[model samples]
Target: MRSRWGKARRVSTLEGPAFMNELQRAVASMGPRVLLFLTEEKTVNTVSELRASLPVSVLIRLPEHQRLMELMHKQGFQELAEAMAAPVPRTVRLQSSQDLPLVRGLNYPCVLKPSEKNYEYGARFKKAYKVGSAHEVDALYRKIEPVLADMVVQEWIEGADGDIYFCLQYIGGQGEVVSSFSGRKIRSWPPRIGGTASCTAAWEHAQELSDTTASFFRQVGFTGMGSMEYKRDARDGLFYMVEPTVGRTDFQEEVATVNGCNIPLAAYCHEMGQALPAMSPVSPQRVWRDEQADRWSREVSGEAVNAAALTGFPVVDAQWRWHDPLPWLDDISRRAADRIKSKFHK
Candidate 1:
């Protein structure tokens, strides 16, 4: 397979043109069969360019909800939800800000999201914001006027905490789940009470989580590596199925691979209907820390690129990296400068 850069044009906090150029050089020399696209920092147009260059498989996280559903229809993803028998949040499409009050009767702490973003790629919501009256709802609408025009208001499940429990599966062309891994999220940064995790562990607990995820994949007949997330119900101890993240969990890929499960390479073989290696019995107890450590070295500091060579703790194969390093580095830098400021205060 030929390797071409995906999403090379868009610029972000990371993976800009300069970064994409670096990625292209690194992958070009390595000779990958496909480009594993990260849509957050790049555009879907980049994927189009790559597929033009080689036989490729591309999966992207959509930045809006409507786009996600549309892509689901195109990529056979919607069928999975239908098959899983999963109950989804009640969604009302908004033509403009006018639709807010009509939907607000459902009331207080509802989820506001774009009708689509290909799939959960860019679903944003102010979870737990109470709107006891229409007045509060209107306030929110006015506050969110800039982005709310294109978004929707949906019935929010009181139990949904967004501590997503993820099930990673290697699926065959026949839609059978060949192997799987379970993980639980602990903390997150965006501080969006229900945002992405700051840390997670490959721990196993609920079997229903696996069964539900498996059924969803079987229905879609997905023939590649995929992940599904569930929001845990703290009271009943069950998870509400959120969405199926098709093809690779940017960070979980490392967790699974390091814990003796190689979903990336395994999914490729499964897609071709080739014989797959047995799933290794990797202990779920394994813990992986991000390789980059931020501190005041008093020396010219830079983020570490090579996580593979970091010694001491058990590092999962190809899973550990400084994918999001700058923000953390900035915090450390500020704290270090504060220490200097303290001495001067004396």
Candidate 2:
């Protein structure tokens, strides 16, 4: 799909019965010069299947059936942060469902999220829940037993959407911070008490988060794409580290593509030791606004939206691509129509 700017070209979707088959097509579609890095909530045999297809890198957040939340605190990610003198949240790992009772003695309304390689979508499968009281925690654990063992309970910081931060990190071959971009999330859904962003803006803050994150990336000898998320405390005004994702943060590659810097393309070029193409720095304050007015209208009662927060900007909203949405809409619409038909027939 081509955007109005005509610079961004959407690729065809690849769905396959086998992970290797999918990888083959992905590599072919992208061409031999491109690099593909694979990361997934669950293991896809894509890495091993496409080992020879092209130069590919794979990072695993968690192994199959391994409790992901438990690995976060134990993994060297936080230790690497401390060694780099980065500010990270005070986290306590739970060994059992019984450990949740200890949180009551600590702080109220603590943030509870999986430390593993999980995202918003995975919450449904794990039945991820956040609560204020000890009772709620216990009840949630009881409701979703084995999965809670890997989760973490940390003190929650209060802040508006502006407090959330995501940085696209690129490390050079010699483990130097080549470039990084900071973006502020404007709005989100599951309403996670945050959902996804309705809009995001390029931003700047104290170098604390950046400096520390660079140090850790350098220490890890990381040579590819990573996104670091943080939340600034409303009370003390300190930025607490949330997660340093090893892979591409969702929407990041697309955002970079639209704005002019293509990290994936850069990564492929860099891996080949080729001089990267001259990249034009995107103007500060680039906006990514969701245009799903119909969805928003369902909540509000009119076509005109009262979204003063996201009014004027060069934005990419949740508008569908007519070129590719047909397959997806067909499946959904067919299911809905079948359900209606069955109800009427009965």
Candidate 3:
């Protein structure tokens, strides 16, 4: 990926023995000047484990081991929020069949989610399930409990997908805020409880959002690229923080970059001890869309997929870029293959 300094190199996933060999070769070739930024948990763990042997500095935002443990696990995150006095949905942790009865009195239409959203657990089930009543919760719990090591039942926040908002910020090693940007979701695939498909840059209610995020991170002693997802309750006008995706760049962080602050780039410069780039004044509202997912969302929701309305505002395509077209092409190819396979199986 192109950064302000230059192009960033990516290492493809490899088999165990080959990966170690490649890692040693890459480190030797690149030397100590290279900084490793890990995006996933597995990568983070691997790099951290090998940090003593590696010569290069790993640019991990959450360097504190305890903080990383708390933020990465759902139940740990709830405890962290409570300790910070931050507002989060009421959550009941279930570790075994003995605790299953806790689901009985939970508010109807609550959500059930695995406490640890690790790769294996996520692959086994969708992120979360919404149950309307106790009976439904019991049934779903019975099916998943045996397989899941940990789980939680949380109150479902009532709001449209657009009500979801994010605060993306870069905190320096000294616990200083280098850059911050906020945006609201326009829509998402899978309607509610899905990844963002369409979103826009906005500062509306940003101060409050920024305060909560900054306070939480400060308490946790976190630094580097971090983001928190929140949803504003339409009826009460209060924002409840859903969770924090600390120590990595958000998927739609480009929305913030195009708007004004380039958080990831800012973090890179901060770590390198270079002068930070001046942030552009938050410009007029800009929209970003994952075209394929946004179109699919419209179709599934039975909403008019109006092209004219999108044209009224400046739009940034999330995937398609002239400079980097291969990733988009690969996505298209994979999607096509999936569709063809489905047709044949039917």
Candidate 4:
């Protein structure tokens, strides 16, 4: 991303209200033309007001919704799915310790998740817990009930990491698809219990998955970058909706760029009312890997990179690049400092 823009960039660590103030000042200093891709809940929620106050041409990722960003919550996506008659797993939401019994009726090996990430509960279970039985769910709830007010328990979708497919779309405000991409996970850290470790472009199923995503957003009147993860059930050969990442790009967004679709660029062009870039052929065989996370998964779970993902294909790493050395270098420097500090403590 840095290489495309040259050295002119304004990076900030300030968040919430403070970040909004900085953003206002930044637009004033940088002039009217601005393209924003945001993840912060506070900044996203309040940007429409800021735009209305100033004569600035601002393009943001999410729709102007005044809400904090959360993940795997009891509300939002699940409700949307059910209302629209979409494919979703039966879920048991735990608002308090009293709701623990609600999960007992679920099928064994259910997936347990903290409703939101704004709590200490995420520190222990980074993604979710696949409990093998009712007893295990009860034991885990004893520890989680004290930390979080809400949680989710759903019947486990039977599939390996490779069965996980995702569709990312840049939906225009007037209900048009500006750009879209479809891909699948080859592996995940924590062996299906955590975040993506590696993934590749799903060439064969791209059209179908892409259409499914575009239709989803169109029906809901969503206008922004939206992504939906679907897991293909091995037992039934059906795809179940996992979750929707609304208002921003997916974490593995660059995978689309590597595969010949630059979603960010397309969205920016559309916002500026410019001609769309000529879409090119994707590197269908390329795999994108979070190298560090893959290594961690290997160390902790004896997980190996799928041979299908590597054989006769290029593996694009998450950070390292010849032109963009700073990001990779910074990662190395930070890890080295941490190692030295640990040695001194020992």
Candidate 5:
């Protein structure tokens, strides 16, 4: 980012206090009608804190504070899902050692992930862990003690990575969906435990999933850019809602634009009370991929990635763009530098 945008334009902040100070100074200098794009949880918290004190008419994705909080954490999401009667995996909150008793009743082959999206568990843990038994969960918990303390143990939805699907929607303030799109992940890093590595638009399966996601979001009065993730349980062939990406566009949000919904354009237009921007022709056959993560998934899990199978669909590389090529170059360079640094350290 520093290479792509000069230091004068992009100031990176590592700590919370420094970030808050920079954000405040930026907002103070900015003109009226601030269009804030919040992709991180800390930014959401900061924006929530500054909403009242700001001197401009800011367009925020999360219009409702309480509803936003519910979607930000694993435990809160489970509770919201239960309240909506949505098919969700049963969760046991592991906030501390005292919460261990709750995990005993859970089904084996459960998953453990941080309750909060902004959890700082360091490099010792992956985004999540799949525990084979109660004993394994207990042992893993002991090893990671205080770090995984504020986590949630959820029932594992039995299925391959291909069974994971998502529905992206930009909703209006009245809980009405302004625009929507749907897609499915074919692979994720760490095999089944990490973020989406490769995905493609699913036209045949989009309708049902989009409806389910819209219904869930509307029921909770969510009014912003968001998506709901679902996993098809191989045992019952049911699509259980895993969680939601609320108040911000998801990482794979561009997959939707590639498929022709053009969510970012639609969202911007709607926020400004303008007519929806003219959209590109729907191309539901397009595939989107993060090359780096897909490589990691393939190498780590030996997952078969047969791209020749989808000969007709064009694949959109996440990091590389034909027009804006510098970022991709920088990414590769950074990877090379890191490799050299690691070798030197060794």
Candidate 6:
């Protein structure tokens, strides 16, 4: 789709079957220079099928298929972290109701989340639940255990969203680091334990986190696109690995691009055997926010969100880009429709 800003954006609906069919057709007719971006887990299987059926390259940054599978499940991630000796939030995996009692001794104010975030399961409820007591945890487990086959109980990292840091990197076809960018979250929707709502591009804590991330990927022999999320424990001043997302572009990737590290384009170039241009040094601090989500978050949490805090820094809208406005428009339309339907039912 061509927007008024003169940029062509590729937009697709999340309907699996139709989406895959269209993607397969497009890949079949496209050349080697065309790169396929896999954004959601719903389409991972489709991408695998495309890999087998078409000669076109799909940008899955993992070093191997097994690594991708490992990162998809929460338990697998815990194991991976253990293997790498990387510090992570204290976590215990539960397979069945029988394993529920194991959490009795766990620290309170922990979180419960699905082991694997498949689209079908994610459509049902919140991404995670923060429980204060064992009773609350047990109750939540009983309610969700039947629907979600596997889950993890993680000790809550005591900190606000601003303590969260991300290191986004692109590993080339030859397994070389092409470029990297880092940022810190300023705020997030759903208050604590939520996806980033606003973040500022900065390299302040990038070195240590980036080194650890690169080491883990290199040890596992991973390639393509890699991003790792970490939270600095306010109590101890140490960063703990929260999760790693491989082979897909994240929502905040544009923040990296705007700050001089164009990861998506670098992945495309590496896949096509083209030499990547030298990356410019990390740009000055810039803020990126999803205004709609931020407003909603502030409303729900009653947290003060001051635009003046970002007055001196450059700001980028996460979704409503001048070049591509359709995504945000569509999101607003869908949210309005859902609200109207909910009111009618009530």
Point to the candidate with the largest TM-score: 5
Candidate 6 residue 23 C-alpha distance from true site, Å: 3.0
Poorly placed runs, candidate 3 (over 4 Å): 1-22, 306-312
Residues 1-346 of candidate 4: C-alpha lDDT, one tens digit per residue: 3453454446474354556666676667665688877654334445543546433555564554532133224466677678778788888888887888788789877888866555377666557889898788888887878777677888899998889999988988787999988889877887787778878888889898988878877766677877889999999988888888776667899888888888889998998889988667565467888888777866676645443434456888898888778778888889999999999999
Q: lDDT, candidate 5, residue 125?
A: 78
Order of the predicted models by TM-score, top scorer first: 5, 4, 3, 6, 2, 1
Better of 2 and 3 by TM-score: 3
The digit string of per-residue lDDT tens for model 1 on 88-131 reads 54445555667765775564565554443422323444532434
Q: Note the residue pairs that clash in candidate 5.
A: none
Model 2 over residues 206-252: C-alpha lDDT tens digits?
25555756776666555555667778888898777777665434554
Clashing pairs in 2: 188-195, 188-196, 189-195, 189-196, 191-194, 289-317, 290-317, 291-317, 291-318
C-alpha root-mean-square deviation, each candidate: 9.3, 6.2, 3.0, 2.8, 2.5, 3.0
Which pairs clash (backbone N, Cα, C closer than 3 Å) in model 4? none
Q: Which residue pairs collide in model 3, if any? A: none
Instruction: Put down candidate 5 lDDT per residue, 213-283, tens digits, no spaces.
Output: 98888888888888999999999988999888887779899888887789878888888878996655465
State every prediction's TM-score relative to the real structure. 0.59, 0.70, 0.89, 0.89, 0.91, 0.88
Cα TM-score of candidate 6: 0.88
**Where is model 2 poorest over a 10-residue stretch in terms of lDDT?**
62-71
Q: Looking at candidate 1, what is the lDDT of residue 153?
A: 56
Please write out the lDDT profile of model 6 over residues 29-97, one tens digit for every residue: 455555667677656645554455434444454456677778767788889888888898878888888
Off by over 4 Å in 1: 1-84, 115-135, 159-163, 198-206, 268-278, 281-284, 287-346
lDDT of 4: 0.75
Model 5 C-alpha lDDT versus the unseen true structure: 0.79
Off by over 4 Å in 2: 1-34, 43-76, 117-128, 206-209, 278-284, 292-312, 318-346
lDDT by candidate, in order shown: 0.49, 0.54, 0.76, 0.75, 0.79, 0.75
Cα distance off (Å), candidate 2, residue 247: 2.6
